[model samples]
Target: MSAVPQERRLVTAIPGPKSQELQARRTATVAGGVGSVLPVFTTRAGGGIVEDVDGNRLIDFGSGIAVTSVGASAEAVVRRASAQLQDFTHTCFMVTPYEGYVEVCEQLAELTPGDHAKKSALFNSGAEAVENAVKIARAYTRRQAVVVFDHGYHGRTNLTMALTAKNMPYKHGFGPFAPEIYRVPVAYGYRWPTGAENAGAEASAQAIDMINKQIGAENVAAIIIEPVLGEGGFIEPAKGFLPAISQFATDNGIVFVADEIQSGFCRTGQWFACEDEGVVPDLITTAKGIAGGLPLAAVTGRAEIMDAPHAGGLGGTYGGNPVACAAALGAIETMKELDLNGKAKRIEEVMKGRLAAMAEKHDVIGDIRGRGAMIAVELVESGTRDGAKTPDAAAAAALAKACHQEGLLVLTCGTYGNVLRFLPPLVIGEDLLNEGLDIIENAFAGI
Candidate 1:
């Protein structure tokens, strides 16, 4: 028999009777710190729809925080992971290395931007990959300091927390952070320092100058950044900013690291966002969508820099789990067969058109910015001329809640919490995509 269709099919209230019961049980069993985006609990998911326990099928725009690019339970990924499971689960790659792990690393080296001979090391999460990138950079350069950008998010690990720019939520209670981490202003032209138009180059140059004076280029080991700041409101650096930073790093003997965890695997309409600016970073940290929902991250970089660390210094017990590697291999194959990069570009085209229209109609939408499929809409209080004004988080949340009630799942993000991020699967149908966009517009209209 054919599988049940996966689309919006609301039978009961969002939480319903069963989901409410489950939520109560979860409250009793699960940790109190655990949080959720939507009240409905997921029972099944495929393509663009997530079937909640209450039988309400909500359109998935979050994509598990941009993890499942090919969509949840993709056929090839399921097949490959299942087949691999039947063969062997874990031999602890460190204890007895396997071909799957090596193969994924090889693929990463070839696929990640940078024409230089590259090497890769797999890890369990984005945080792990980022940490390893720093280790490699320090090992190679023998420097003590690392520079990160304002509104940039690397990870939650101690070291990465120090590297991360946000203070509350991500690093509020968690302290004392790792040392030798410095933060500089990002190239956000929308909120330029001097209110200058097209200030990307100036912003980058000023940041480089600060680094040279305040944190001496010679003392800096690496300059880590996200090409399109993910949690920082999906902010894409100005055209020349990244390339200029890369050039500065090269001239100053500092390793340039691109954190592509949220932007890689065709999500940004490119293999890596660094490719958009033709900036070849020395190291690229990736995760989220790498393994089609599996927990796999990687740090791929120039071979010499990656190999600078001693042999035993770089691995984890579950770094490149066999199952996850198999899923990654399948995910990569799926991207190629489906041409997800092209799909992402198409998504951008559609989203840009729709959102541009929405911006024209709604004064609350202060800005709509992003590249390819990775897009966001920053909402401000009504009648705000300056984009620099803090976003209206309360209004954005109300809109998101309304969308959820109306059978769509959208997520809000940003430093100020006013941006709504769109990270739908590249495979979502045009009809469904339009449907979700309609929900967003309707929510904004209601607000």
Candidate 2:
């Protein structure tokens, strides 16, 4: 069936009777540090709705943190994974390689933006892909320094943590980060020192000037960035900023890496967000939505740079696990068959329409921004007229809690923790999608 029927039945309170009982058990058994954004527990999910253990069906706007883009329990994915399971689960690609791994790499080269000769290496997570990209860049350029933008999120590993801009949840107490990593300012027009009114070219030129002066282009091996800053708010770089950086990286020996973890696979109405500007990075790191929930990531780049790293240096024990590769094949097939890029464009239309209306009605909504389905609404304490003020984190947290109570799952992101990111499955039915958006509007109304 193209659309699954959804019924929002709340038999008990949000956590419901069964989930509360399990939550208590979970607290006793699970580590305390592992936190949850929503208190409700999910038992089943399809399309865009998550059925809680307590029988309350909540619309899922988070998409398992943007991992399950094809949707939870997609039929094709289940069938493909099931068939692959019958064949064999793992032989370790490094020890005994498989066609599934090779097939996935081939697909990556074909699908990722760029008409040039491209090569790919599969990994287990975004962090692994990013680390390998850096390794390859350094090996190819014979440079030690890597430059990342401010408010960019790479991953949780020691090296990626050093590359990440946030400190509290990601880097706190995890000290002694990797060396030779540098940070530069991002073209966040909302908070830019020069302001957004200036032309995109001017803003980009200024940012490039800062990078050239501070880091010295010759010493840098790579400049890594997210086309749309994922965790640090879904801030799209100013128009000219990405092209300028890409050109600079080319002019110098620096390899430009686009971290497409949260922005790829038709998430932004395109196969890759970098395609929006026709800016091709030397390397692209992708994960989250690549495998329809399977743990799979890839670093696709120019063949020369990718081949610079020795074969043994680019692989991992679990890299390109057969099962994950099979899942990716299914996911890619599903994306193409279902025309998810069109779905993402449709999602952008709905999101822009509703969020723009919401921004008008609500004073606290400072800005509504994003491209395609990867959209976010930045909440400010006062309103949009008072400039880009940080929204009250406590209030945003409370709003999220209220949405959870009202049978809707949402996630909060941003450097200041005030932006609400909407990552609904591209397959979400219009009814359910509108219902979830309505729930958000209601929560904001209550606020």
Candidate 3:
């Protein structure tokens, strides 16, 4: 019951007839600002593949940017969500409250990193969770400055836009960002000015120095970082980097927040990516993989810090909708019963093995990084294999287009737009995963 029928059957052309017609309709109705990587429209999605309106089955390499880790149509999610739908939809937790909402918080408290006394507050999305975490941190420390890494992506909201690092599509033209936000260096191994071996210590030292000189530690409320950067590329922070930052935050009385929106819930072979380095943050923000594709997010933290905000200062109308809570419960149960963490680790072995063999032949692949199912390959100029790396954004785009044409869905990201990320569902079948990788290999060969 945990598995979906594993196959990559193409019924028509990549976009086919029906999808093309819908694409035309979408062009007229959808906002010009909103963008989709592929022009095709999805009708059904589950383990391994998403079926388009034209009946083309494309292998899924992007789980809605790491949302559906339990697969899109997981049986438990469907069952629990269906029962809740029949009972009652929205009573507003702030008005009457519900057991489902409390249960989700209980799960968050138990599942998030740190064995210390913990508490949680649910929200509707990752961005909301992040914003709330910041609120709690500032209130707890009675400080104004919030520090974030150079390549981290928080959200699209105005305050989060200020928190985010990128300037193109995410932050461009959206000005007057929130105040008291400062940018610092992240331990990106591939692009560090120093060599990869020195990335951790060097980056940490530089970050701490900046915090002390430019922004006093006493004025800082929190230090937020993504253990594995997502939209900025699937860059896993260099080993020892996170631990160093965590210690510095502790010494300065600054709340450390691990943004695990895209790296949590077994997506990285661990419940939380920070756990890999034993970097237990005072606060952890989660979404994306929390509720089996439903909208749900949470900020779990030490009880003392989380309680800093008054009752009326937190919560929203749809913070923990009963249906979403039901889906989250089902997703957690499915992750445990299916042992998704083990699956993610196994997938890392399979994918990294295949990608390494390919890298041996292809020089354009400048780097291979990330943990478990959440992985990426950085593409650079084909000839600069041993020289200064030059990003190959064109090659990344071309590879993704080639994969789409062959019924394999892939996504491109990174500050340089040179990273081809892979986020296959943990429940995907081995045959399907290898087949998808084969398509990627073939695309690279053609390139």
Q: Considering every candidate listed, which one attains the maximal TM-score?
A: 3
Ranking of candidates on TM-score, top first = 3, 1, 2
Q: State in Å the error of residue 438, model 1.
A: 0.7
Compared with the true structure, all predictions reach lDDT values of 0.89, 0.87, 0.92
Task: Mark the 10 consecutive residues where model 1 has the least summed lDDT.
Answer: 1-10
Lowest lDDT block of 10, candidate 3: 1-10
- The residue pairs that clash in candidate 1, if any, are none
Stretches of candidate 2 above 4 Å error? 2-5
Candidate 1 lDDT, tens digit per residue, 1-447?
003365677798766898899889999999976688887888778788888877888888999999989988888889899999999999988899899999999999889886789989999999999999999999999998999998899888999999888887789999999999999888886667665456677888889999989999999999999999999899988878999999999999999999999999999999999899788999999999999999999999999999999989999999999999999998998999999999999999999899999988888888889987899998888888364465799988998899888888889888889899999998887778899999898888888
Q: Which candidate is the best by lDDT?
A: 3
150-242: candidate 3 lDDT, tens digit per residue:
889999999899999989899999898999999999889888877888999999999999999999999999999999999899998889999
Minimal lDDT window, size 10, model 2? 1-10
Off by over 4 Å in 3: 2-4
Query: Tens digits of per-residue lDDT for model 2 on 123-172?
Result: 99999889989999999999999988888999999999999999979999
Winner by lDDT between candidate 2 and candidate 1: 1
RMSD of each: 1.5, 1.5, 1.0
